[model samples]
Target: MKKDKPKYRQIIDAAVIVIAENGYHQAQVSKIAKQAGVADGTIYLYFKNKEDILISVFSEKMSVFVENLKVIIQESITAQEMLARMIEGHFKVLSEDHHLAVVTQLELRQSNKDLRLKINHILKEYLDLLDDILQRGIQAGEFIEDMDLRLVRQVIFGTVDEVSTTWVMKDQKYDLVEMAPRVHEILLKGIQTQ
Candidate 1:
């Protein structure tokens, strides 16, 4: 697959930075090419267009997220620990990559409806993993068994997503990763049987 090529990875990484700095609508293929150190036409070899590049950027980064969560799920840990680790992992990834945080939290939201729909489709895998974590918690009697699974999933995801977006909006002055534990506590309190 083209994804295995070194240049494909280069273009994806460069696209994140360019989209973060320039906004999705303003981030031209030429700028991405320049940032990737590839010719403008070279991008066409890998992507159908700028929209394809944008979608690919989300797809590639989100796979890292899904894979990380998958590893955490496989560990012999309590549901609480798994949830905590999930929060930490989510926050840590964004905290470590400011450009990616901006692209995902800010730039992606500004895309057209069709583009947002495509991004949402890519997000379903990540959301499903979150559901897996919540389901595990419920099965272990760590969370309430009577709650609506779908709504709970939205609440947890919205909390994490909003916190990251707020941090990005504030230019990331605060430590996001540090906030993970506190956020995890709040979420657990709402869903865990007290």
Candidate 2:
């Protein structure tokens, strides 16, 4: 598979920077190829076009992202702790990569309807992990008994997402990762069973 080749990752990584700096519509295949240190035609070997590259970037990065969260979740004994670690990990990862933050928080969200649909499909893995955590929390009495799992998942995910987007939009003026504990505390209080 093309993904198995070194250039594939090189191209994908390059595409991230290029798209983040140029925006998807302006991110040319030649620019990506140059960033990847390959020929323009080589991009076609790994992707159909700019749109495919964007989707692949989300797919590849999100797969690894969800796996890392699963590991962090497993390390915690309670759902609350797991959620905290998940928040920390999410914020830490994005903060460490400003370009990725910009791309995920802004650039990716600007894609066309069809592309957004595909991006949402890739996002399901991350959302499902959040749902699983909410289920575990309710089961363990860490959360309310009558909670709506779907709505709570959205709230949790949406809160973190909006916070990160705000940080990106504000030019990451403060410590985004440092906000994790506060976010965790606020979210915990909201869902914790009395």
Candidate 3:
């Protein structure tokens, strides 16, 4: 319920920019508060500490991701079509937000193993969308009938995640969204009943 508040979202969005610019260690709660245009104590109302903010940021962002994918899935699109759209949607979301790209791809990964584990828990919702596509594709006879769903999910998610990370590492020098189609082709070749 706290997440429904406007300042909560404002704080999360500001956290992205601050964390991206300052890195996780150097990004302070006060900086986030300044960015959010709220008092420093206001953050504590929604989050426990800086760690909580980091976790919440990922949660909030990925929630948007899962919601978008749900809409795409509901359009009655085939699993193969959904796969392509998912890739495009993934790339487009990060491409449009460089700060978010940096924070997610660079900053978040540098967190301690325990923190990383927590982040992975938040990622399950997004990962389920990938799994849904694989299962649906298998059901529709688009993917290999004997496909290993778990392995396929990892491959798909890793490919998309790696491409985005690499793009961020390269300072986003190239167009990321454009690579969606090519990436989709490579993934389909591996998973589709070719």
Top lDDT model = 1
Instruction: Please tell me which model should have the higher lDDT, number 1 or number 3.
Output: 1
Clashing residue pairs in candidate 2 are none
> All candidates' TM-scores?
0.98, 0.98, 0.97
Model 3, span 42-139: residue lDDT tens: 99999999999999999888887899899889885699999999999999999999999999999999998988999999999889988988899999
Q: Which portions of model 1 miss their true places by more than 4 Å?
A: none
Clashes of 1: 0
Worst 10 residues of 2 by lDDT: 60-69
What is candidate 1's local distance difference test score? 0.94
Query: Which residue pairs show collisions in model 1?
Result: none
Residues 121-185, candidate 2: write the lDDT tens digits: 99998999988888889899999989888888888999999999999999999999899999999
lDDT of each: 0.94, 0.91, 0.93
Model 3: CA > 4 A from native: none
Alpha-carbon runs more than 4 Å astray in model 2: none
Candidate 1 least-lDDT 10 residues? 75-84
| Candidate 3 residue pairs in backbone clash | none
